[model samples]
Target: MESSSEFPTSPSSGTTAITNPGFPVSDTVLSGASLPSPPERTSSQGGGIPLSKTASNVSSHSHRQSFAENQRHPPPSPRTQRHPSFTQQAIQDLMNHPPPNRHQNPRYVGRDWRDVAVGELLQPDEVKWAELDMSIQEATKTLFQSSPNNVVLVRQDSSSKEAMSTFDHSDLNAYLLAVVGLAKPEEEQVALYRDISVKAQSQEEIPLRDLQPIFRKEELVKIPAESTLDKAIEVFGGGVHRILVTNKDSEVVGILSQLRLLEFFWNEAVNFPLIDRLYTIVLRDLQIGTQQIIAVNADAPLADALFLMSSEGLTSVAVVDNGHNVVGNISTVDVRHLTNANSLPLLKASCMHFISVILSERGVEHGRDSFPVFYVNPYSTLAHTVAKLVATQSHRMWVVESASPSPSAPATPLLQASSSLPPLSTLSPPAISPGRTGSPTPGSATVVVPPPGAITTSTPQSPSTQGPFSSVPASALPGAGLSGRLTGVVSLTDILNLFAKSSGLRPLDPSEQRARRRRSSSSSVRPTLDIGRENGRGSVDSRR
Candidate 1:
């Protein structure tokens, strides 16, 4: 296997705009580049109006009271004690001593806010892959072991710069659906063979080309090696998740991923006091993570939702109603319940069919229960947002509002969690039917929930009792619902972006900008997250 590759720090070349319909135009552009007009928005889409920075005075008062009350009496939970001390300490150190050259990419030197380049934030990409000839089962297993994010790169030469044939996460899923019977089959024998031979031999012969999108040179969006991180973020602003980074020869040097960018932002926020300093910030002030809501109707088959997420490279998708009311959310974390078990019977079935089996079958798994989606209001302060994220221990929160009912009838309040419900500890993980022969029984195989919430807090008797940053008690988020409809999303990554942008909100003194420029010129390589060493431990598990 190849080790992580490094590239030169030269300034990136030209900037390119994303053509995806879902994204907004970036606020900043490369020097001399004309800023593209932002796409217009419909009310349902939540884009037209400028986000308000000032929280209502009443909201301020209520927030103050809530904070004071929490300071007076803190709640107790097992999660707090389990937080990795190294993570906490590293953040604290970063807060006190932010590196003089905090920006990781050096290509941004001499650049103003509008001229800021995307290359500054670019890092050597880390992604998983499988050749087309590999079996699905083998690829899936190898992918999860090293890269739990579970989106594998299907390529002939994954690192190749030239025309690369590919199939994404969605293709793998669509294929699974076909083989398992939800999707129509091309031929009876092919389907039957897949069912028998695939399960029996654990391999398949078809190349990935059958499912790959037609390769077009223009389809592969590339950026020069020296483009600013701002340009990259703008490219992402168009809902493009990953972009190809290239050198003068147009040879691919690295891949920039939205997930990596978000991770970088989150890590930076933790290292700095930006969260506290910018407590008054609102959703309007920062770049929302996902431009268009990658949503599915609540009534849609779970298979459909999975396919959407897989195709979009999203871990979760909002479950909405015909009226566009955000109802619930389903993510990879929920999918884990099925994937962890002997899911031969469920893998190919509609989500409804599979959900039924889990709810009604035997051998109940401890942590595989389904749960409602957690949300935040668009008008809520960043302080409140961060509080909810920390309190719930969540990676992302849905932003929604109560939609106006039709003119024909009286309005009704949006759905709310009942205060009378029992504690989470009382809820059991749903049951699922046993697996085929050789499948691990509930007692034999240890199952772990995947992504966003994969960081385990404790060895629980039941997994359903908690989720990655599950619902914050209603009391904890007092007045969060006052803000209106689903506008945009603010994830842990957005929080980091806010911190990064906050630095640019005020123009740097020429002296300060010059100092930064000098620092960038002298910087050799950016510091890396040395997980094992940082934690003073050796094994990955120990670091966790």
Candidate 2:
């Protein structure tokens, strides 16, 4: 990947008005662009007072013209108007007409945002691949082992070399749902699958092809690798989480995730004065993200949180307690823990307990607590938020109210455990044994593993015993001192959208687009006025 300092020179500056090819012109006038003139009307057509006609005739003619003109051309509907501001127009023009020599320009300098290409910032694609004939167990293992924890399934005999589908956390959720005998009824599953019936089965023997219904076959959003960063931002502004970077032949070369984009911006922020200014603004002043939060109770079954994620189309959900304090977080990525035979029973564990187990697993597997609790307050600066997001590799940060520290109490780390739950460092490694089969029955004993060096009790403790916030003191819970009540959730998408808006290129609202489409369809069916000359006379004909 190209470093921030290696970018080429920005496009030359000028007052030259350039046409935007692919981007839709917004409903407001762009800076430096001429305002469009209103539709033309004729006095003879009754649009204005007829100078050659009688007073009575003029009155009636003007009324008719006004109605006809209004019907034919509505007065600059917001959907049809062009509203690209000066900054947006400049960015679009830059993208439409780039310099001939991207690297050799005499004025070329490092870290010029305008000259950066999506391909220049793209990192190596870490996505793994699996054959359709691969067993679910093998595929799951491969997926978890991969960095991004996703796999592309392809046909062995296919000639196009295109991926048949993708398998990710969502697919794992479905498979696990079936394994636990909690698969949705056939009627409810209709929208998810076509013909295959998913049922509780052994992952070791089932080929991925048999579970085609669970594969994500949605069309992958892609962009040309050579496209400018502005174009990528435009696509992302439409709510896409990531886009596949494609080469000239349309073959996907790399993936640009929301996190990766933000990381790049954070790294190169010093080079761009505008971005640096944006970073200093507090989140409350910008009000960038949605206030509505979708969360799961910390005491709810871990599976419930995963199901909620799948249903709500969320990558993660805030795990909160009864008072709505964010206690922890659970994400689709955590589903990887279930692939282990020893961890399968955690499906029915409380979300908090499940979180503890996953944290412990991370320490054992990766030698540290990979999952860190991250939160920010409304007063937090955008720079702080971005720094935390990039540092933790988290898609979001829980926005909590700023808590007033007590004079008597000393400050504690954000991840500090309350008396109810043991500290993460004291957790021991989970005991992995062989011969585990089928999903654990209800009321089965769930072993909560602590990190190495933790004291273990002789008697095995259930997940409920391990950690349930109901009995814990409020003052002892995580975020008790440094954070307050949960207010909202800010995500990577929100930050990216803000950047796009700052450039005067606001994301197109889906609802507005839908309304525009409706109006267009309706107009196509409406009668249109066709003017023609016949028999040495002018006539207006209404045609559908």
Please name the candidate that would achieve the greatest TM-score relative to the true structure.
2
Candidate 2 lDDT, tens digit per residue, 204-273?
3667777655432333455666666766665566555566666766555676777778877776666666
Which lDDT values do the candidates have, in the order given? 0.38, 0.51
Q: Write the per-residue lDDT of candidate 1 for residues 258-365, one digit (tens) a residue.
A: 555654443444343433356556654654544345555433445566655443345456544433344445555444333322343333333323322322211122
C-alpha TM-scores of all predictions: 0.42, 0.59
Alpha-carbon runs more than 4 Å astray in model 2: 1-114, 148-160, 185-204, 215-218, 365-371, 403-482, 510-544
Q: Best candidate per lDDT, number? A: 2
The weakest ten consecutive residues by lDDT in model 1 span 1-10
lDDT of 1: 0.38
